[model samples]
Target: MTFENTLHFAQQLDRNDPLRSFRDRFLIPQAGGKELIYFCGNSLGLQPKAAREALDRELTVWQHLAVEGWFMRPDQAEDTPWLSIHKRCKDPLAQIVGALPSEVVPMNNLTVNMHLMLTSFYRPAGQRTKILTIGGDFPSDQYALETHIQARGMNPADVLVEIFPREGESAWRGEDICNAIDTHRDTLALVLMSGLHYYTGQVFDMAAIARKALQAGVPVGFDLAHAIGNIPLWLHDWQVDFAFWCSYKYLNSGPGGVSGVFIHQKHHNANLPRLAGWWGYDEDSRFAMTKGFVPMAGADGWQLSTPTVLAMAVHHAALQITAEAGMDALRRKSEQLTAYLEFVLRNSGYPLEIMTPADPAGRGCQLSLLVHQDGKRLFNRLVEQGIIGDWREPDCIRLAPTPLYNTFEEVWHVGQILLKFRT
Candidate 1:
């Protein structure tokens, strides 16, 4: 679509968007008392208007019942009250991540969940002690891997292997990931990579990588922070060993919201020693005050303590929205919106380059762009104009027109402002 024609096309798209009604649910942020065109969902999603109400319900409980709210289930004087509220969200959370209800658990923040998962999954021994991951992964992941290695009495350099991007490739190909697994099979303990890379916005081939990793006797896992709500995933069908994600990003669960973990059913009873706590104990026997730990079976076995119900309440609201929209339906529109953004940028005479995968199956709504030398200036200018997209250091700027709240016209307008930085 040309610059003159882009607006018309965008308006046409907005009219036809099936998910258009969902946008009204959020309280879009404002700059200078005017609404900003937000395309930064990859970093932090726009707040759903329902979020405040959901959290408010908890506040009301706190005001009235105080600590009694912890044990009062409706129609049952015995049901653990506020404590059981977290369980209410389990099914929807599981459905959103494409896992069995038993395979997913709402728990701590992202890095803490990763550490917990790694404690169980990253048991490198003998010669196969190295963990393989992609370079340019999110910094938290890098730190987690390094610190985990040292904690295991292993040298980070010797036990952590990062495969660099190919010379001309913006993101590593599936073949390269498979090759790395095949070549290092004898010595590699695990393959951990971002489901959608934070810097490049490229969706890695999780199923393909999982298949290869399993075939090579290696367990595979993903950091799904950027992929969970932005794309369709089949973790159970993919036969992934494990995965984890924070709900605050694409799930719109508010900042520092409750995160979760997924453990394949096969591993739930595999006698793996986890960093367990009271919450992981069998619910039936937890209050009985047993001597030894009897895990609650499946993903609940990974929980460490009583859940943050207020945080979980916000996440439940977000997941309910996602469930209503359906992952496939949102993804269908996301592909078109992102592609349209790319199309408009190509027509602008700027030294701009889109680093996100061009293939729809290999990407989400996020598009990470390289702006040669004036990236920071261009990014600041866009922000000043109330066209909000996030900037990463060096030269990359990231934009994500999330399907839940972003309009096609917003996408086009952001593109127009980006085009202005060409000269």
Candidate 2:
């Protein structure tokens, strides 16, 4: 597919995009009566127009039922009990992450869910005490690994093994990661990694990593913070022990929205150690307030507290859009959108180096650019001109042409802006 650096070519691509109509479903941010070209979906996704109605329904329920909203079903509806409202999100979320509905649960924030999952999965014993993770994963995940190890009366320096790329390399090689896992197999209690690196936009081979870790007698987990809605995942088939993701980014729930968790069915009935809460108790006898803790089967057993109904409501709306568009179709568009951006950037003749993998299968919607000089100035200029992409400290600018809202014309315009700034 030849890409042209012209408005007509961009418009032609947009006109032929099957998923183009989905763009209207989102609330695009505007400035001075003009819509900004938003490419920050890697940080926060555009809001779905249906989110307002979804949130309002929950608010209305609260107004009428108050305390009873927890257990009562509305007069008009038979199935949507407030007490089990989060359950409505399970199937759609399961579809997105490639899991059984029972294996997925929408609850808590990303880091908190990581803590909960780590409590159950990261059991260090005898020769197996270390956790292998990427060196510069999202900061919260790094902190979680360190603090969790510390909480268990272990020194993080002794128990945490961080894998880094070879010299002069911006992204990790899948073979290197598997070799690292195998090398430290004896001391590795768990292999924790991000599905898509937040900094470089490199999509790790999660299934291969999981297979390598498990073959070496280690449990593997992924922080799918940047991967969940951005790419297609098959957690169940991959046999991942556990995974967690925030809905606020590619999922587009909202800022600090509820997260989703995936636990393999193999652990559903296991007597795994976990932080206990009433909502995690077996639902049939939950209201009875039983004496002993009998966790509900599957990922629901990992719930720590009552569901955040309002946040989950917004997430539910977002997941509905994801379901309607379908991951396969969304991913197809994402590849084309990202490839177009890459073409434009490479042709702009700017002193920019794309840090993300060149292979389409090895990245998501994001392209992290390593600017040569005055990078921050360039980023600010883009911001001032309403070309919104995020800047990481040091010298990287992250742009994500989100398939749900962003168009090819926007990508072309961004390229023109980059060329203009270079001049």
Best by TM-score: 2
Name the weakest run of 10 consecutive residues (lDDT summed) in model 2: 73-82
lDDT of 1 by residue, 102-217 (tens): 89888999999999989999988889999999987999999999999998888988887888888988888889889989999999999998999988999888989999998998
10 residues in a row with least lDDT, candidate 1? 71-80
lDDT of each: 0.87, 0.93
CA-RMSD of model 1: 2.2
Candidate 1: list runs displaced more than 4 Å: 1-4, 73-80, 421-423
Clashes of each: 2, 0
* Runs off by more than 4 Å, candidate 2: none
Q: Against the hidden true structure, what lDDT does model 2 obtain?
A: 0.93
